[model samples]
Target chain A: MVRSGPYDLNVHCIPESGDTIEEVVAVARRLGYSGIAITNPDSMKQLPFSGNVEGFDILSGVEIRADNASKLHGIVGKYRNKVDIIAVSGGSESINRAAVENPGVDLLVNLNIAQDSGFNHVLAKEASENRVAISFDLGDLIHLKGGSRVQAVTNCRKNLLLIRKYNVPYVLTSNARSCFDMRAPRELAALAALFGMSGEEAMAGLTTIPHSIIARSRPPAGYISEGVQLVYNEADTGNIDEGDR
Target chain B: MKLLPPTLRARTRYLAFEVISQDPVRREDLIRELFSSAGSLLGDVGASECAIRLLAFEGSTGVIRCAHDRTDRTRAVLASISTVKGTRVIIHVLGISGTVRGATIKYLAGVDVFNPKDSHI
Candidate 1:
């Protein structure tokens, strides 16, 4: 397994203010995130300047939250070719199933945000088959406190246990809305322990799995199926006119 | 009273942490936040047991003394602190060591987060 540092691949929309994205980048870079994907549901286009920053990579992602299967499929088809990671907001049972069943959906995140234990065995199996990584968001822990936090953690642990049992890929994130909400990797690992995730397991979600997802989802080079690239033979391309303009 | 035996005395764990904030941070403010967050998150009993003591603060880095077994709880308490005096700040635990000097040198040697040249404000 590659030992690259963690990447927070699911950050909510950050309002386009004066260099606000810069602030978020600085925080994530300082916190040691090697890569991050800003998942905004409203944005029509990716960040034009999302490139390498002080050795950190900024990836563009889209989040599609739909009320029904048809709408979810429509959004997925629309954004699958546009974003790096196509995330589906999975809170209700219907959405969870739709997200897992759809091959265009790359990430199934926040499955338990709105309800108690929104994910299940069937969803887990489908997600595994579709190669959709589940998200274990630590930002929710910060938003809640006391018994509610405890309950949330408990629900997360339950979901994690099922995800692990089925051997489905999972990812960890702060789900930060702003730069201030970002956290260190160790801090996130410790919080994951509260939800029955071992340190190594949590680190894998933060680093290895996300890394694979990014690698697989990256816009293909000379694009084609895995291991097959469209080769442009020099002889066939020689007839094309070359102009500096 | 006689000194407590080694077996009975609580073991110490030094946590080397970095504070990421927009403004210069005061050591006293960190101490107060630690106690407040610890008290609020873990309650009085848990807070007293952890007994977080600020050993050193240089620039935006610091070493804190916490109970050996309670290191997890102390780290958790520190992570719970989101804002210090209404300014958003992140307390990142670099690592834990048995000696304050070890933690200081290992994680925070010549820490320059609050350096005058690097100051954001």
Candidate 2:
């Protein structure tokens, strides 16, 4: 069985319009979260993090939202190194295309909000290659109802089918602006079920997917690419300073 | 008229949920919103068949009853609500069980707001 207490990757925090980082942590723990990424604006990314808050993992993140593609490229290039998670807001078809095509974008949120999912077979293939995750912002489902909500969910269903078929990474987030906006993990799973995901699949979207994203974000140790880190015993490799001299 | 046979009666589900808001939520407003959301989402015929009933509301906690087949739709309606009486609010579903006793005793038993010692918070 998948473990509960899913992670939220798109919470607005600190110096912005959302809840303070401390308040978010306090309320998230009470709501039974395993970990959370406080994805504030890029300006807040430079602010230091306190390792872990109350034993819950708190990852610092940045979200880039510009109407034009060049600005998005510039912002992602600057903040990709600075934050643990990088999310690009998806609204226009162009923004969606730019976000998934760029290698630096860790997540693309709001893909299906304004129109379609902003991804066709070609775009879906590129996103899969780049490992850019697509997030279903629960706030959309919460705030929009009637026909608009129906349209959003229908679009999400279409997106989900393509995501699964093409092997694109995907996640679920509340995009919570306040402590009160967070939902219980169980509730989120139920909502995902309505969008054509199984309960286990929903749990994976909440838990495993985010966990793996964080894992991928970590820099490889020993300063080497895949399958190529050199090692030597301390006794054998000692006196490197003297050897250089 | 005699009551319908046990097997003929609708199998119901109890949904335990919590309301996170700055102000106390009145029962009338909660009822109105439930029907309003159900109606808007599922339309008149679907909402009419939902058979929603507000079982209880204690502070931030509540238990709602709906038909077995309509539980998923009812949960979506619960998720769709973001406000009550102009105050912004979020409704979190705790769990769903077949009986009221199961919903309250198993799910809502330790959900008391006053008891900080309760671990389920």
What is every candidate's alpha-carbon RMSD to the true fold?
5.4, 4.1
Look at candidate 2 and tell me the lDDT of residue A125.
89
For each candidate, what is the lDDT? 0.78, 0.78
Q: Is the docking of candidate 2 incorrect, acceptable, medium or high quality?
A: acceptable
Please report the TM-score between candidate 1 and the true structure: 0.86
Give the per-residue lDDT of model 2 (tens digit) for A42-74.
645455562564468878788787788878999
Residue B93 in candidate 2, Cα distance off native in Å: 1.9
Q: TM-score winner among the candidates?
A: 2
Q: Write one digit per residue (lDDT tens) for candidate 1, span A1-245.
A: 12288999887544532235667777776777887888876444456445666577877788777888778888888777666788887778888898989877878887656648578898889988988888888877766777777777877988888888889888888877767677877788877776668889988988889988887777445667867765666587876555732
RMSD of 1: 5.4
Off by over 4 Å in 2: A1-4, A43-46, A219-224, A230-245, B114-121
- DockQ-derived CAPRI band for the predicted complex in model 1: acceptable
Task: Supply DockQ values for each candidate.
Answer: 0.36, 0.41
Identify the leading candidate in terms of lDDT: 1
